[model samples]
Target: MVTKKLYYQDQYIRNFTARLQKSGRDEQDRFYLVLDETAFYPTGGGQPHDTGTLNGMKVHDVEEIEGEIRHYIDVPAEVHKEYTGELDWDRRFDHMQQHMGQHILSAAFEEEYGYRTVSFHLGTETCSIDLEIEYLSDEEMSLVEKTANKVVMENRPVETRWVSEEELSNFPLRKEVSVSTDIRLVNIADFDYNGCGGTHPDSTGQVSSIKMLHWEKQKKKKIRVYFVCGIRVQKQLQKKHKVIQDLTDTLSAPQEELNETATRVLLLNKELEKKNNDLKMELIEYEADSYIEKANVQADRKIVREIFTNRPMPELQQLAKRITAKTDRILVLLINEKDDKLQLVCSRSEDAEINMNDLVNHVLPVINGKGGGNNSIAQGGGERTISAEQLMDELVDHVKKISGT
Candidate 1:
């Protein structure tokens, strides 16, 4: 059996001696080097593996398969022969700070609120824990963070031990014990205890601080809490300060008046929306009045046609429908400002024998466009290259011919 030294004693490991037992290629055509012994911790338990140089080669990843640790490296073959390994100390210590902080926070939650940490994930940016309880109020979370930081400030010694399977029954651990017969457990004095193989700070004080950022209800019985520790807490505070400064400058208000300024901006936007809607209704009403005044009154059938100006498509379409409701022999055209596009709508009277679809088909091609519609009511839109008056005249002439007037 290969002896993994780091698993039993994480603190004593600064450097180590190892032999390259074998080398092989993985499925991805990358080299995998096996060492007789290593201080590098293979990724497990939701915590990432340690990264450093192996034998003068950059160790990109470390993984465990069938109880043997394999190091994935990126270097030419000549360098691998002169191998000397180093661990990333700053990264390792940061992991230690975060893992230790989790123990204290998890313990405080159980002690204060009787909630258990059901699951946990240690991400590169932040760490999160899912609790058995459905929710935690902001005030309660503040108390929890305050209590955890108090433990850090007190600087309680953290102890690690190897216990036999039978010895595990004597100590009360926060999580279920899952490991081989030999178990490495970490204890935060009276505050917390758990079976963990991940590296941790020697004492609570080494963590420096703990900040619980937020929490959300995951389900009826689960709440996920997000937190940062040590250097991450400092970084988070800096980010929040920058955001507040930006808000104050953009709103042109004092820092204390930021919230009120934001509320006023939102209210002003709502008032503008209401006024815009009222203006649209007024334009639609005016277009309908103009269409009625322009109706042809000489023939047996009355025909009304008007080209609308200065209106959005939606308002113009509403106007067309209103005009059609007032008179059966009506044709409404609207031109959009941006692209100079035109929309046509025609309603036929029973006495008028006009096929609106055929009329639109003939007119659309003349303006390098395309359109289609039904017999009584037809509608289409096209580019406004031709003058709106010329287009309306062409449509009126076609309607008059089709109506035999």
Candidate 2:
């Protein structure tokens, strides 16, 4: 078995005694260095590796390939001439805080609710633990967070020790041992004891704080919990405080009144939308009346027609539909100014010889544009060219020819 330096001693952060075991090139041409023992934690047990310097070279990644701990480093041959290594204490301490926090939380869940943590993952942003229970309600989660933080403030000492296979068999462990032998168990005093290989704080108090972010049901028998610990808890509180202040300022209300103010604003927006729809329908009725009165020939034969308006495109399309419903032999071409562009709408009578689809194919290219539609109606919008009147007249002439009117 490969010797793990951290497994035996967790406090020895920097040393010059570690010997270079092997040096070779990987598949990517990058050099991989192995050491007899290392302070660098390998990527395992859902926790990332520790990064530092090995033999004066920057160690970028450390991984456990098979049973060997391989360190990927960037360095010249001269740097490897002497034996030296350094551990990144800041990162290592953060992992310690998170890992110990997990122990406290896992134990609290089991002690209070009889929930067992079946799986745990330590990520860069947040850590997660999957419970054997199907679900944890919001009330239970709030209680768990409160209890976990209380334990952190209590600053209980965290202890670790190696027990023989026989000793481990007698002790009351929270979970069954998965490893073969020489089990190193971390005990959060009076709270939790589990088989874990990840680095952790010397005491539960070093965690500072623990916050349960949320939980979700993963399967019929599993629930996943997301949480942060130590400095992460402070960051979350700072961010939420700023958001609440911003909302209070924007709504011109007290922080306690922000929710009521937001609800009122949403109700007002809904009322405005209903009023706008009523106005659009009234505008369509007025436009349709004028177009029907001005139609020169109203018969069973197809009649191509055009209308120019300053109204919006949606209103114009509604007007065209209203006009088509009044005449059995009418084809309508309509245009309107909207924003900075011109909108077009074409509607064909059921008995009309011309189809809007054929007319759109003929005219869209004239305006250096593209459009498509079905047999009854087609609509498109494009950049304005000259006046609305001139563009409308040109389109009407094309429609007349296509309809054979």
Candidate 3:
């Protein structure tokens, strides 16, 4: 048996009496109760389903399957001869306001700039419509918002009428209808006429207000215009005002000086960062000089092996480069055991005969790591199973074998 949809007759019907038809379980083991007539709207047309109570059971979801409107409850309900369904009016009215506002805003865009609405979405906090146009300038957006607000202020009646497919030509429709049979067209006076199944307010003024927040290019020639209506516009304004006030207080400046104060603060931060980096580089250079003095001299070739605690990887590279630059007879091997992980860096002078890449390749597997580099320099990191001192000793042994020492 097909469930009669009562919402089409009255969108403001908060309570309805219906007859219980059947109760059953689906393949997913979910219980559902069917009614002979229902005012709860099922999920369709970019709008969500109505959530309320049915026969004292919490109705989490309402769906129309095949020909029956199933009220999926949180728990199994006993079959009753008569059932009472209550609608969540706040949710229902909010949807009506946003949905009706969408029709007006979309119509305003079309009337002002010939932009066609291709799709729409009623989100939790906002609503958006996709337009066929590639871009919408700020001025064009302002004009459309102004036009929509003017319609809302005029308090025009919103009428719904059932018409046949042949009768559709009698009205100026903004878009084509999807269903031929049971065609319900929502008309906004002479402004907009389109086939829609969603619920809406009785008048344009009930939408309260419509505010276009912003717009962005979605894909190829489509632009998504984000907006809010009714109570949401006031919410957005309150949030923005609080943010501005906080910024004014924190910066010790008035609202008018916020832009200039922010720019000056950012510029000063950049300068401080540059000076800090210069000082760090000078410190690393001096540390490199001390490392060269503490090297182990072998066969007239200087070898520098050191372990650091929580030193940055870049500083290790810079120290290696500085040491190698000072002398062509030196090989630098550096490791940092910071953060309970092992990291290695190997560098050699330009005239050094040893291939640092080959040395790194041999040491990496011992700690389950991977790395590769040119003949003069290489870097790698791995697990901390072995101490940094152990890796350094292994690297020295490899160098000795290469030098036949």
Candidate 4:
């Protein structure tokens, strides 16, 4: 026989007595108990299953499969035929508040705007509803939130009843019922009527309050609204307040002045960064000039070969550019040790006879790194199998041979 779902009869039923009609273990060796009647709400309709105790044994999960409701438990139930089930009221009531809140909020969207809810998910900490629309403006969201809270304030009775398919047309439903038989309708007084099997509170006010956290466009045309309700609203407020207080202390400004202070700080940081970059460039130019003056003259060609320990690649490039710009007669071959690897930068003055690409290509395999560039400049990095000095020596020796120096 199909197990009776007591939750549909009374959503507030926390404790109930039922006769243990069946007991067995699943493939995973998880013990399961089947009761003739139960208050446990199985996982369905986007709402998670109820978790509690059945005959002093922990009911970890409740699921309905093939018309049979199974209460998966931590251990085997008592050998007795009768069992007492106690629901975790906090989790159940929270879910009820969130589920009912969704109904009210969704109905408000439909009544005010033409937005239709395409999907709903009741997550662990928050819930979301995907609407069949591309976007929801801030003003439109505020209107829906206001309307939903108004319904909660009105404390309208939330009514649930099972009706046959023929009786469906009697009430205005938000959407058509999915089931032909045992059609359960959750009606919000004179506001909303829809087919649903999820548990809900008796009145909209019991939802406490609903808040729209945010919304984003999904799948190009749909809008997903993230929200929280009941106790979660207070929890969100507390978290935001804590963040505000921390920012106030960090910025040394009051909450009201936070926006202005943050903007000012960002602008100041940008200015400081620009100034620091200018100073770094000046130092790089000075260092590059020093290297150019120390270049070795071989066969009437100036070659500046240098090795830096643990230097960044960008700095090497910048130094090479500065050295070439200052003197067109100097060939630059630079190497640096960075991140446990060897990096090389080769550049030629416009008058130099060296081919940077050929030099880089010839040395890359020596250190197991790959790189490509034009004739004037080339760069690459590879494993630290060879020291920075070795890579620099290889490039210099190649340049010397090519220049016949």
Candidate 3, pairs of clashing residues: none
Model 2 worst lDDT run, 10 consecutive residues: 74-83
Task: Return the lDDT, model 4, position 107.
Answer: 97
User: What is candidate 1's lDDT per residue for 48-83, written digit by digit as tens?
Assistant: 888888756788898887777888876433323534
Which runs of model 1 end up more than 4 angstroms from their true locations?
Answer: 1-8, 12-17, 75-82, 284-405
Per-structure clash totals for the candidates = 2, 0, 0, 0
Residue runs of model 2 more than 4 Å from their true location after superposition: 1-3, 11-17, 23-31, 55-57, 74-80, 219-221, 277-327, 330-405
**lDDT of every predicted structure (CA atoms):** 0.78, 0.78, 0.91, 0.91
lDDT string for model 4 (308-343, tens) is 888878888899988988997888888888788888
Candidate 1 CA-lDDT value: 0.78
Clashes of 3: 0
Score candidate 4 by TM-score against the native. Answer: 0.84
Q: State the lDDT of candidate 2 residue by residue for 1-405, as single tens digits.
A: 374665447653655456667777778887777777778888877778888786567888888877778888775333244457787877778888888888889888988898988888988878999999876899989888888888899888877888877788666689987886878888877777788778887878899999999888896679999999988888888998999999988889998888899999989999999999988787777767777777766334544356455766666677778888877777787776665677678886777767787776666655665677888888876766655677667777776665465
lDDT of 3 by residue, 145-255 (tens): 999999999999999999999999999999999987999999999899989999999999999999999888887789999999998889899998999999999999999
Provide TM-scores for the models.
0.74, 0.75, 0.88, 0.84
On the 0 to 100 scale, the lDDT of residue 158 in model 2 is 79
